[model samples]
Target: MTSTKTSLLGLTRAELESFAVALGEPSYRGRQLYLWIYGRRARSFEEMTDLPEPLRRRLDAAASLDRLSLVRDTTAPDGARKLLLEMSDGLRIESVYLPDSPGNTVCISSQVGCALGCAFCATGKMGFYRNLTAGEIVDQVIEVERLTGARLTNVVLMGMGEPLHNYDNVVKALHLLSDPKGIAISRSRITVSTVGITPMIERWCSDDPPAKLAISLHATTDERRASIMPVARAYPLDDLMKSLRRLAHVTRYHVTFEYIMIAGLNDRREDATNLKTLLRNIPVKVNLIRLHPTGSDLQPSSDNAIARFLDWLRQEGIRCTLRESRGVENSAACGMLFAQEPIRPSSTQRRTLDTDD
Candidate 1:
């Protein structure tokens, strides 16, 4: 059951200290709470062995270490696991855990659903529900790590929502996730995928973004792009490219462009040439992604078409990789996350907590 107390999951060390001080405890108690909550991954105050019994009770009364409830767990044949997590309001979001050799990666959602309405994405079809608090976003990583019993080496904000749309919360989540006193995951290990929000990209670059930026550039031209991704209509291709070029100049990291190959939509020889020209001066690595089934009429690009596109990019001195679809059988791949069976909440008002609050 969801707790009414303030959630401690998303609070930073300083914020946690402040919270402790508010409860008539020493500021160091907050540091202890940070270690217990993030380092020890404690689910309840009772599990905080170092904390005094009375203090534990006091913490339990004022703060909650709440986590999203795992509603459904599905694993694809390729060993990728999809987790459907239910929020306090019963709105569910999906996260994907891709287990690999030396490291594991979890793709987490930043919103209950997406508003972008991308033609090939399943999440976009659900329409926008609400923006996930920083706590909700961070918990997806903690919960996935707990459920899988595998330490996550990488985190991707590429699961269900357009992360940039929920800018404040997403940035807050990034701070908490990369804090050395807590999860301590390096900034380089994190990747945020956006559908090219030009203003957000420029802002993120100016602020010295922690994680690498990946732009979803499925089509070469603005007309074809806007046809598939509605957000493209607001921030056109030219403006988006200008931002990326600026980003290339500022950040040392290579900006990866994710191009989804649909059957006959944007997988032509002309498209490849245009794409090369568009990304001519930008420092980018292109990932030619095969279309994952989203229960839409759209189909994946032909293998020959994918090969030709790859060849064209390589011939033009562009760095490109052909990413074959993974976890497709169970709809756990890219563009396939949709919480089909979300539980409805009761009449009680849902409580949301954040560090800034």
Candidate 2:
């Protein structure tokens, strides 16, 4: 298996320049190659027509550029499209492109499967597989651009796995996504969500952080949260809130809280009140997501229940929005991204790696 370090597509402009100089090519060659892959969105070396044939041959021989392949694509009635991407290693992941009034938004996955074990999520049930390389993540966005012929304005790292778990690669992907020479998408257009990984959040706030942060805050009470997301057992509500406070204070961005309304679970009026009390001092917006049926024990909150919950939050003066479910018919809604292929465990199973580095 060749490592990504040998791949040219994933390299930053500076890294590409260094590689080109090491190969005794002019510095301009690296910039040309960067523009070819990112600006021109070329897939194969042959497509880089501006580069001389000899240089293209040298580049191809030194490093391979091919990364992700679009295995399947499904469009929703609402015009949302979901893609099943097969990585070079044959590991599968999902990415979604949603058409909004402003522009299209692409939801990219950071890991193959999830290890968080959130009870309501289907990806969690699939177990952790492998972390996706930065190239793989960037390739999904490029593929979407190629298909739509329109620039993707917004990106949300809320797909199969928790992005904060795959911190380094996720951050690298963000940098590549926001690079001025490439996609040049503003950091504000990218939103990275996590299931409250405190240490990583703290580091992200202190270090170079992305534009927005969203926490998967399903429950207000620690006990209730622990029952649903196993991650809560490690970082409880109080601890998580402290970290969130630091993030908000440092970044000055109102964090978004994602609350999935499960019927007979956390949809009660009292739950709304508890949520308000819990988020009283934090700068936050609550996104109430209607639970998409994943054929699990969980059920979607009734329309009445969701309306009542939203009304309660409004009465309490909390900013809340009820997110409309998209692509439910295609299993592309929240908590529904898992490979449809049969799981065939390898003879030697790789140890599951934590995404929280």
lDDT of 1 by residue, 136-226 (tens): 9998999999999999999999988888888888998898888877777899999999998888889998987578899999998888998
- CA error at residue 162 for candidate 1, angstroms: 0.7
Q: What's the lDDT of the predicted structure labeled candidate 1? A: 0.86
Worst 10 residues of 1 by lDDT: 348-357
lDDT of 2 at 346: 64
List per-prediction Cα lDDT, in the order shown: 0.86, 0.83
Model 2 lDDT tens row, 1-357? 754436876778888888889989888888888888787788888899988899878777777887687788998898778888887777788888898835789988988888888888888877788788888888889988787676899988989888877788888888888887887778988998899888888889888655599999988788788888877878878778888888888888898999999887788888988887788678989999988877678778889999999999999899999987888888888888888865455614434655333
TM per candidate:
0.94, 0.94
Worst 10 residues of 2 by lDDT: 347-356
